[model samples]
Target: MLPSIIIVNYKSSRLILDCLHSIYRQGQEEFEVIVVDNSDDEEGRKAISGSYPVVKWIRMEYNAGFARANNAGIRAATGDIILLLNPDTLVEDNAIAECAARLRSSEYVAAGVQLLNTDRSPQITGNYFMTGGLNHLMALPAVGRLIRWLGYRLKVKKTNVASAEGLVEVDWINGAFLMVKRTAIDKAGLLDEDFFLYAEEIEWCSRLRRIGKLCVYGDLHTLHLQGESANDAFGSSGKGYYNLSDRKGYQIMLSGLVRIRKQFGAGWFIFHLAAYLFTVPVYLLVTIIRTLFLQPGRKREWANWWGFSVNVLRICGFVPVILSKKPHFYKVL
Candidate 1:
C-alpha cells in the first residue's frame, strides 16, 4: 500500500466524519483513511461506522492528547507513507496526490504538506525546523509580540511552501496536515508521547532532520479548521500553558535530547529553575489579571504557569530534549 491517511478524532465527530467523507469523495488517489478516536465513549467510532463504513476507526478509551494518538495510528498504518491530518481539516482533491508526488520525487524529504484555511488561503504551519529557542526568542514576550505580529500577520504560508514547484529542506512541519514517510517515522520513532497537547511535531521533526531535510510541496493544499484543536478564542486564558507549553515542551526536549547534565554541566539547569520558581507565581498574577480583566473564561494561562513551574521543580537532574537555539523555522500559510 502507499501512504495511509491517519487522523485522530476527538469530540467533533461531525467534523471528523465530514473530513473523512471528503477524503473518500474527493481524495484523488488510492489510500485508506484511519481514524483514531480518543473519545472514550466510542462516540466518534460508532458515528463513523454507521455512516461511513468504508473508513477504518480505532477507538482509545481515554483522551490521549495529540502525540500519543498519532503514534497509535502510525503503528496501525500499512502504508509506506502516512498522512497525519486533523479531524477539522478538509482535503482537496489533489491533496494526497500532490503530497505523494513531492515525497516520491525527492529522496531527501521525510514528510510534509501544504495547509490552507477555510478561506482557501494558505495557512501558517510554522517551520520545518521546530525549536524552543526560536519560539522563545521571536515570541519573547515584548519583542516576540513584534515577531508574532509579522509571522501571524505577514509570512510564508503552507500552500506556498509545500508545493511541487521546487524542493527545499525544512526544519519542522505542522502536525495539522503533515505527511510523513513511514520509514521516517521508523527512523525518528513515534511522536513523543510526553507532549500531551502540542510541540510533538517539532520534536518529531527534530528527529526527521537527523535523517534528511523535510520536503514541503506548495501544490497540494488542505483546509485546516483552526479552532478545532483549541478553544474558541485564546484570549488571555489560553496564552499561559500555550505559553508554558513551549517552556515545558522545551524542558522536555532538553531532558530527552540533550542531558541537562551535558548542557548545564551536572545540575546547572537549576539556576533557570530557581528563577522560574519566582517567575511562575508572578506570571500567574499577571496572566490572571490580564486575562480575567480583558478576556476571561476558562483561560489556562495561570494553570499552565503553575504546571510548568512544577516541571521546572522536577527536571532538576534530567537533560532537555530540545535546544534553546533559534532557527528559521517555516510558517504555515
Candidate 2:
C-alpha cells in the first residue's frame, strides 16, 4: 500500500480541495487522504467533507497548530508510510509514488521532493539546521556570503543542490512535503508539540537523522503555494511582496528561540540573542536608508531587521510573554 497522506488545513478550503484533486488524479487508487482541519469552523469542515466525502476528515476541537495537528493525523494513520503534506501543495505526476518508493527503502528514514513555486521555478531544496556558532552567524547576509566564500576556499563547506538528478543526502527537507517510514516514526516518536510552528520539522528531522539518512529527491517535484496559510495568521496586511507582517515574523523568531533552547541549550539562545541585539541598531540604519532610496522589495530586509530587534527584546526580559496567549494564540493559525 502507498503512504497515508495527511494534510493540515487552516482556512484554505479551496486550496486543500485543489491539492486533494491533484493527488487523487495523479495517484489514482494508490493512496488515502486524511484532512486535519485546524480552521476550527464548521463551514470549512462541511464544505470540505461535502465536496470530498471519501476523505478521512479529522476535525480539530480547536486550532491545534502545525505540530499537534500533524501528530493527530499521524496517530490516526493506518499506512506503513506517513506523508505530511501541506494543503497548499499540488503533487505532480508520479511524485507521490516516487516519494513512497524512496521511503520504502531501509536506507532512508525520511524523504522530500523538490519544491517549485507557483511559476514552476525551483524553490529552496533544503537547508542545514541551525547548529549555532558559525551557522547562527550565517543568518546575516553579508557575513554569510563572506563565510561561504571562506568555507568554499577551504573545501569544508557542505554543498547544497537544487537540481540533483537523483536522491541526495541533505541536512533536512522542508516540512511542506515530507514522507517518513513507519519504523523511523516509531524510533523517533511523534513531532514535538512544543514547537507550534516553524522549526518543528527541523527538530523532528534532527531526531530522525539519528535513525537514518534524510534526503530530498530532485527527480520528483511538487508545486507549493508557499506561505499561503501562514499569510492568514497575519491577515491581509501580511500580503507584502516581501517580508512577513510583524506578528508572523515575531512568531517565527520566537519559535526559533524555543527550538534552539530545546535542541541546543540556554547558552545557544543567549549567544543568538546577543547577535540579534548587536545587529538591530545596524539594521535600523539600513532600513531607513533602504526605505529612503531603494525599491519596495528592499524595504522587506528593513522590516526583517526591525522585527528581529523587537523579538530580541521580547526574548530577553523586556516582555514577559512573546505572544499574549503564546502557544494557544499561535495555534489559531
Return the top candidate by TM-score. 2
Every model's TM-score: 0.68, 0.85
Which consecutive 10 residues in model 1 have the weakest lDDT in total? 324-333
What's the number of clashes in each of the models?
39, 0
Task: Please write out the lDDT profile of model 1 over residues 94-179, one tens digit for every residue.
Answer: 67766776686668546555677677766665363322223333422233455567767766343224333344456777778788
* Per-candidate local distance difference test: 0.60, 0.74
lDDT of 2 by residue, 1-333 (tens): 658999998888888889988877764767777889876757877877887787888988877788999999999888899999988899897798778976796588898899888898887766675356345454543334566678778886564555556767887778999999988999999998866777788779888988888888888989998888877755634321233236665566666656666577667766766666766676676677677777555756765776666656765652234323244233323
State the lDDT at 331 in candidate 1.
13
* CA deviation > 4 Å runs, candidate 2: 133-159, 236-245, 288-306, 317-333
Error of 2 at 98 (Å): 2.4
